[model samples]
Target: MTPPSRPKLSLRASLFGRFSLADTGHDLRPLPQQPKGPISMVMRLGAMGVLLGRTTRLVFSARTDKGDTLRLAHKFANGSAVFIVVAMSFVGMIMVYQSTVQLNRAVGDTQLVGAAFLKLLVRVLGPTVIGMLIACRIGAGIAAEIAAMAVTDQLDALRLCAADPIEVLMVPRLRAGIIAALSLVIIGSCASALAGMTTGVVLFSMSPSTFWNFELIDNADLVQGIAKAFVYGVTVPIVAGAVGLSARGGAAGVGRATTDAVVGCSFAIVVLDSLISLMSHVVAGL
Candidate 1:
């Protein structure tokens, strides 16, 4: 049996869509039109802009709830622990193996393998690769969570209660994102470096002494890697929250917002990585 087709207009929507009757009983009324395509896109973008601006303000505001933020941070940390460990371990191994193979093929000696891999992994790949993974998983969750809240009028109720959703919701996610991103990158970077060094020792016949001499990571690299982690941490949840809060169209809207959160956060992480690398180079040169 075919499922009944859902009415285009709810009782409320039908009431809202009603117009004055024409003289003829046979007069046909057109369906109420929803905003289509580009207009909807533009409106969504504008809404995201406003939401992000508010979220950023909330992140730095003294009035935002600290206890709630901390609670959220703790929750995300505990929840994501296994995922972080497994994902980073595999990513680290892959990064090391891939970099080693490419460099060794080109240089023959593979002596610079550790140095090259460390340079790229610490400053760029660590946060970004990890962030892309988070954007797909955690980011989508954040978006859906907020979007569900918005669709259910929970966000509206919060506003009516004189509570700021930005503080209670987005700020905590931002904190969680930073904590998660940084933790993952550090764990992943160490794992990757170890994998690279081990590969150099076992596969490339590189002596442990020589591998150590190549200098897997330096103080500057450590600092830069942490900075990248912080940046990615800040980026993902804010984007997710913005998309989520702006969502319309109920579950379908939440789904779109979730998808956008994934794609937007991934793209943002890659773009930010490039920008940060360039800025770091400029600063280092100066």
Candidate 2:
């Protein structure tokens, strides 16, 4: 005998059943709650303590590193800075003499020519001294520090310790760089101005008052130049530090990082200077 006929399924019911099964299969399970035990609590506390300690150490290390870098840079390069300043001063003197002589021939005023030469000399000296000082001191130090850090794997260790390496290391260096740059600009400008005045009086026979008469020698230009230097200082150290921190392999990596830091910083300085100059012109126009 034939078995009792099975109930025929409608298309809509079949579709519904299939969808229901799929929905049930795809439903997500609730996440398990973490066990609340004494051991777990202790572990959590220990982790927090380690985090706090690392943060404290990072802050302290940044400050100490910045101070040490600045000191070393100044100590090692002081003599070189002085020599550069002297050489630039002499060059300024020669340039001024030539400029003044040409002007004198054109205008038939030898006295005014000598006065112009003195003014030019003073203006050129200050900037020259500042540039050389920064180049020899801050520039080299940044390169070396980044290279050493790369060589030592200090940066990698920082990452392993869960530190934001850039904030800890780069920010302080950037701040120090700004300070150094501004100091160099101010000191260099004064040195150059004095040298120019001296050359005018001794070599070109110009009066001190006449040499200092130009309004361009005042705070406006000096401030603009210092601002440019400040940008350079901040950028150089940061780029150097970043390069060093990202270095890999071994000695070869350190060498590459060091070279990249120097070349990159120098190029950055020139680009920043140009941008600042353009901005200054725009501001003046406004």
Candidate 3:
């Protein structure tokens, strides 16, 4: 096959004296069109949905390779744990102080402080706080790495080697994400509970056993927190992966994808937590 010609342009070589601008008369190649506003947002959301479905399907497929899964899981877990622990501990302290102040005003007893702190950590803080942490910590990294691979054509090379990108990349990340998120949630829950307990014991002058003695944590709290973790774990990878996979324009695009992934995952965690929490309440009632 032959190639198409660059349409020839014949133009005056002078504006004042030998001044010509970009060959002066040739029509410029059309610039790439960008999707605008609502359309662009909808397209991105649609792409994310598609990738979620595709990755979910790939997750169900049997595989012989466990090395990637295990390695990534360990890597993500180690990277995220310290930050989560520290953050949760601080969060726990603040909650304890605030809850103590409020409850002491109302009940005039520091004993009720433990009950409020326990409920706050188990019901809300454990999942939402951990989810946001993972978004900033892991989600951004995944998006950047995948975007770099896409820009450098490594994804193409993977396909050339007959590897399915979803199986090799997406599925492993999905597994690692869920495992790491769940682990972090458990650790965070403990850190928060311990903080609340310590603060109650020291500042509020409550007994240590008071912390766990309260019936603050019901079965719904446990179930909802776990569900939020799973939802967050699943959401982070899907949003990051889809944005990374679709990245264009080299370094700039990679940066954009990472930013998008972080923002999207954070927003997703909040929305999912709220919706699921409400849904769980409705379901429990029925």
Candidate 4:
């Protein structure tokens, strides 16, 4: 005889869908929506802290697949190169053009434009813009991919094999992301500088040597840029992975996760940039 039919359990979603309940074939249920407001913020922060701690432990104290990390690094770098270069090149050109226009209209001194621009690019624009761009591009890809896997039950398969998905999937991306981000930041910065130099020369008839001056930039600027890029690199994957892993449903869930990843990564970049800049200034004042 067939097994007795189980009772049909009906559950209702709460307002804002935070506690939406669904019945998967194996009694699977969507987790509560991540809450908002101050208390929710605190709770999420604690959860993220735990996640980062676990990831850090896995990366440093355990053996990760070296080949996988390298492969992902290569993919991240190559895939991002053209986008970063072209975008940065345009940014450099626009900034130079605008600065020159403003300087010409005001005090008639364009000599300081390149110097000041270089300083800003190194300490602010290069790292920050690259971070934002990577958040939009790479972060979305990571979220979509992971969300798809999660929705399709592949993550469950990993659990069945006694593997921590974070160790198997996210750790490599974290390592590879850092490597790729640093390299791309350097390349994008060079493209921006060169494009700015060319813009000054072509548009304003400025001497190439004069516009290429590096007088305003120092060790501090270099350190800050690298630090920002490094932080952003680490932040994007973790944020994206977290969002993706939380995904449920099917295609709609993947799309939502991708959008969330972009928004979350961008916000993280802005907050980190502000904090890093604040710390740099505080330290420099000493």
Q: Write the per-residue lDDT of candidate 2 for residues 65-183, one digit (tens) a residue.
A: 56655664465345345655566566556655666667667985545543444343333334434544465456556666756775686755765676555545555555656666665
How many residue pairs clash (N, CA or C atoms closer than 3 angstroms) in each of the candidate models, in the order given? 0, 5, 0, 0
Total backbone collisions, model 1: 0
Structural similarity to truth (TM-score) of each candidate: 0.76, 0.62, 0.85, 0.87
Clashing pairs in 3: none
- Scored against the true structure, residue 19 in model 3 reaches a CA lDDT of 16
lDDT of 3 by residue, 49-72 (tens): 766776787786836288787888
Candidate 4 — what's its lDDT?
0.82
Pitting candidate 1 against candidate 4, the one with the higher lDDT is 4
- On a 0 to 100 scale, what is the lDDT of residue 150 in model 4? 86
Per-residue alpha-carbon lDDT of model 4 for 50-156, expressed as tens digits? Answer: 55666777887546678998999889889999999999999999999999999999999999889999999999999999999999888998999988998898887
Q: Residue by residue across 1-286, what tens digits does model 1's lDDT show?
A: 9997754543222221221011112212334564668865564455455555656676777376677667766766666666765676666567666766887678756666667666777777777787787788778889999889877878768766877677777777887778877777777666666766776677767776666553656777778778878987887887788777756678898999899999988988888888877887898841
lDDT per model vs. reference = 0.70, 0.53, 0.78, 0.82
Where in model 4 is the C-alpha error above 4 Å? 1-42
lDDT of 4 at 92: 99
Best by TM-score: 4
Q: Name the best candidate (by lDDT).
A: 4
RMSD of each: 10.2, 18.4, 10.2, 6.0
Which parts of model 2 are misplaced by more than 4 Å?
1-84, 108-133, 160-163
